[model samples]
Target: LVDHKQTALPALIEQLDSEERDHPIRKLAFTLRAIGDQRAVPVLIRAFPKTLLPASSDYGIKIEDPELKRWIAKHDLGKGRSIFSYLRAFREVVGALQQLTGQNFGEMELFGVNLANTESQRHLQREQFHQIAQHWAHWWEANQESHGVDPAYAKARVLMAGKKQGQLLDKDMRETAAE
Candidate 1:
């Protein structure tokens, strides 16, 4: 494990956009939280809803709540399984954002709607979270300067400023780690 905060932060940030299906997004979120950098707040907000469903599920499909509930109930994910496999990653992203910003956007209001036990309720909760992500984005835009976050990372409202598709991870960003 690399201990250099400079070397580690950008790599972790880049992983948030990893297209790899099983990319352990929750781990990345937790790692960012442990780093305790204000910089991670913006990126976390950017990724808040990227993994609301299992990787095996279609990332682009937009199923209505009623249909999603029927699908979840009919499939019978078995005794120990859940529809929340990857949704936990989204939760971790929320947790990291709150920790870094010292703000409570209301976890219950953001995620705890209806206990989410019913499949229909889970779908509704997922939609609520997507809306909450928007709230976080708006809040960050207004508060990033006060938190000492850079404008480049804040303005585009995404993970990295120059995030090249072919660029190597953590290659050039380390030099500015101390800043």
Candidate 2:
């Protein structure tokens, strides 16, 4: 897709904020990450909240522990409320941002439902998520001018392409034919 960035980039950026239930936000972010363009940062940030753990539940993960599953099945604390965080599409956006910017803004931890059973614990979790999101947003505001293709992301792309296809594709996906 990077080779077709002239068209692919804009289309992906345009839909990065899509709220359609079946839109592959995760795949879009992944392609943008592979493209390694700093231009996608803002759109990626915009899409971040849609992937967050909803306010209805303190826990951000699906219950996978057999014991926890049994307990949740018995309790009415709000089953199915914590599944979003477990999906980790948010992490893909974060990972893309990290790759594109070569920065770490931190991510929220997934916790068991019991940990957030109390109102205070839930509130704390919510605050932490907000703070992390804020950090990324603020960082972008302050550092967008410095944004560009991260060297590491670029280098890895080159090496991977070379090893896989014996064709060296640069960060822009140009220079492939010459190589």
Candidate 3:
């Protein structure tokens, strides 16, 4: 799979922008992490905003309680369904980014906060996730080019050695070895 990841990377990235709800974009993002390529960083950043909104209705439902709806509308709490979906997807996207970069950048703690536990928690966590997402976006913009990539030949050799050894090398070590 490591040997095949280079060929799959392009398609996985392209899936980030696909409008098809049936597309497993989250899975694709995680696959990019499994590929362990630094090139996936920018693509994952781009996918972050897109992931904040769930594609399926199963994630949550619209606010049906009139009192709750009015309170939310007045207080600027997001639409109930969107908030739930956004938090769920936000956590997932952040998880993928962490996996790809080996850099937490504070997202690990932010993502750990359970936004769906209660209304008050959701409101606070929503703001936190928003800020964290923006921070990640800006960080990517400033640092993407410096993220670095392993040359194809070198990556292939490492993959071959790992396969022969019947064990996968740690991703961070692989990148360090490449450097």
Q: Which candidate wins on TM-score?
A: 1
Per-model TM against the reference:
0.56, 0.52, 0.48
Tell me the spans in candidate 1 whose CA falls farther than 4 Å from its real position.
Answer: 19-23, 54-87, 110-127, 156-179
For model 1, give the 10-residue run with minimal summed lDDT.
169-178
Ranking by lDDT: 1, 2, 3
Please write out the lDDT profile of model 3 over residues 1-179, one tens digit for every residue.
44597688777766754522323664565456556777766656545534433223324335678775664344221333333232244455666677666667676664334426566756555555545545555555456656665433112111111144334234533343344
Cα error, residue 85 of model 1, in Å, equals 15
For candidate 2, write residues 68-156 as lDDT tens digits. Answer: 66643443223355442322456556777777778875463532222255777766654454455555655665677666544322222
lDDT of 2 at 39: 79
Each prediction's Cα lDDT score?
A: 0.57, 0.54, 0.50
Candidate 2 worst ten-residue window by lDDT: 153-162
